[model samples]
Target: MAMRGVSHVEVFVRDKVSAVRHLRSSLGFAHVADCVEVDRSSALLRRGEVQVVATSGWATRAFIARNGEGVAGFAVTCDDVPAAEGAARALGAEVSALPRGRVTVTGIGDVAHTLLPADGHDPGAPPAGRRWVPRDGAWPAAGGAWALERVELRLPVALRERYPAFLSRVFGLERHPAQRSWLYSAPAGVTFALEEQRAPVPLEPPARAAAGSPPAASVTAYGLAFRALPAPVLR
Candidate 1:
């Protein structure tokens, strides 16, 4: 498979506006586009080379109702989408054809990969609908103040070996030696690690009652790692 690496990640949330605001304020992401349909709303945000689509609507509500707000899937850029989809299917991966010639391959847990052409179409671009005013300008270059460095997946200890093998066979990622986890480096410089977990683990402890907030969702199948770059000095 001619995998170029992850193009963008899709996160399902209850409120697209709030989610986008949080990402912009907390992660330094810039709102790029918005798509609003009768049933749902989605916003595109970017920082460095990382793009995230936060969506909410009927389908999103149902997803969050079941799984809570978290990453739903990610798209990978491919030189040949059809060929990559074929390769993934040959590896016994559950594959589904999405609209606009995109392909989705189910991965561990609920996470899936949407295979997209590598012709520079922003996978995070606003889908067809009522379009919000798009911010004009090129996306910030990679290696900015904060950049996604790695993505760590926590799965059952039983899948520690099989999952990595699956990724290697399907995506052609190269496995590397790691102390306590399985690390695979993608061609586009993203490191993916599978960490073993005997039982379900929450991302953080329950929110205090007086805080009047719900506890954070249990750790999902994956978590992102970002690095803080040094501020550029001006002479």
Candidate 2:
């Protein structure tokens, strides 16, 4: 099985509209698509190779109620979904099959991992049950100016020794030779690090502010690092 790096991060928010607005206005992301179902609404945004799916509604309310607004899970592209799912199961990960042959597995805290087939399809497309409707008007050109550098995950110190090995075996990531930090990297240029915490920290939901106030900090479990690329030199 080949791990093709993170395809997208799914964040469960109380307000999808607010989340989408903040990302587009503050982070230079472009809203690409929207997915609406009976129980949920999702907005897909992209900036360079990074994709974010902000979702709200009944399906996400339970997660937000417990952990507050934060990342519910993330999807990674895999060459063989069955092989990857089997490997993760054998390594003690709780695995479940989803619609359209997708597989989801347990990860640290409330974070789950969804395995998506890397079949040369557009990675930013909405998942099953969500129809993709392109947004109107021109979107800001990414021009490969943004690259996801790292994903930081915080876990209880008790699992420090075993969790890194589990991630390596399941995702085929290389373990960085650091005794203090459990860092793993993939060939696709993204790093996943397990930071030790005394206990799981619940992310506080973004506070409701008066209209026209600055956006509040996004509630997220994954600490993301992004690099801005230099403008291309013109001859």
| Candidate achieving the largest TM-score | 2
Query: Model 2, 160-219: lDDT tens per residue?
Result: 777776677767777776634645555557777666553335544434557888643332
Local error of candidate 2 at residue 234 (angstroms): 6.4
| Tens-digit lDDT track of model 1 for 35-57 | 67788787877776677778788
Error of 1 at 16 (Å): 3.6
Over 4 Å off, model 2: 97-101, 137-143, 154-162, 177-179, 195-222, 230-235
Report how far residue 83 has shifted in candidate 2, in Å. Answer: 3.0
Candidate maximizing lDDT? 2
Backbone clashes, each candidate: 0, 0
lDDT of each: 0.64, 0.70
